[model samples]
Target: MSIHHRIATAAAAAVAAVALVLVGAGPAVAGSPHFIKNATTASLDGTSLVVDFKEAGLESGSVETITVTAHLDATFSCVNGGNNVPSDPKKTTISDEFSNSDDFTAGKNGNVVGSLPLSPPAAASVLDCPKGQKATLISGTWSDISIEDETSGAFLAIPGSFSF
Candidate 1:
């Protein structure tokens, strides 16, 4: 074979080898699990706190469960005598965790999306007020919000907290 032909053949083989290596590595990299940027979000919907999150690079067709958790800080006011009487406002800090879960199947792109709706404890239920006094929620905050993958026991996202 001519020298020029031999050199051309060697260059083609090298390029093909590199291309094969990259092709083989693609799936391994794509199959790794990760959280999509800005895809996880939290907001207050009426009396419920809604959390939405997206995870990618999961096993396709696999069943996955995500759990959302947060700590609630609530403030309440108790009034009597139809606002004719004034008293100190009561504040309650609920350190206990409130959580919700959702189940989803990973799509063909190895992505899963889910939402969790968390409801805060009622002010009347958690507060003590004298007879004829009404308990009202003044304000509340859901802090330390986080989303976890229940199937893998890994944290997918932590979008912080929201207030209402």
Candidate 2:
């Protein structure tokens, strides 16, 4: 091959290698959910209503399902419990406090798919939430929730939900 042809071939090969590296290092695909967030907020009014939450996010086609698990977290009480969040509300009795795990499936493009309810739980807590004078993500061991997406085979956990 001529010297010019040899130089052209070498340049093409270098470009191809650089392109491969760049693509490999780039961020995940557009459909890949950067994070799975459960914006749903749960609350209670003296054991009248049991709240629940479901993680929300854009899914990476890889994530077909996600598991929602609870954590051991807490909310602080206030001297003037008025306007207090469920963590430490003043007048009402907070009955159900549970710490358990649940699962959900991913929607199209990482959308939120399911909700894990607080009142009717898969597992019941031994302790009565309203009886206690504190905050602990309902009446259970899981103060926070965990979400494991099957697509990426990863876990994302959160405690609080959007009050919606």
| Top candidate by lDDT | 1
Q: State each model's C-alpha RMSD to the native.
A: 5.6, 11.3
Which candidate number has the best TM-score? Answer: 1
**Distance (Å) between predicted and true CA of 30, model 2?**
6.4
lDDT of 2 by residue, 1-164 (tens): 99999999999999999999998995444444434344544454433223344444444443345444443323223222343445445432232334334444545544545544433322113223343333333332334554555555555555553221
lDDT of 2: 0.44
TM-score of 2: 0.33
Q: Give the TM-score of candidate 1.
A: 0.69
lDDT of each: 0.77, 0.44
| Tens-digit per-residue lDDT, 1-164, candidate 1 | 99999999999999999999988875433365766658988889975788888888787788888888888887777777676334565545565689988788988778898778999878788778778887777678888888888785657556566777
Evaluated at residue 32, the lDDT of candidate 2 is 44
RMSD of 2: 11.3
Per-prediction count of colliding residue pairs? 0, 25
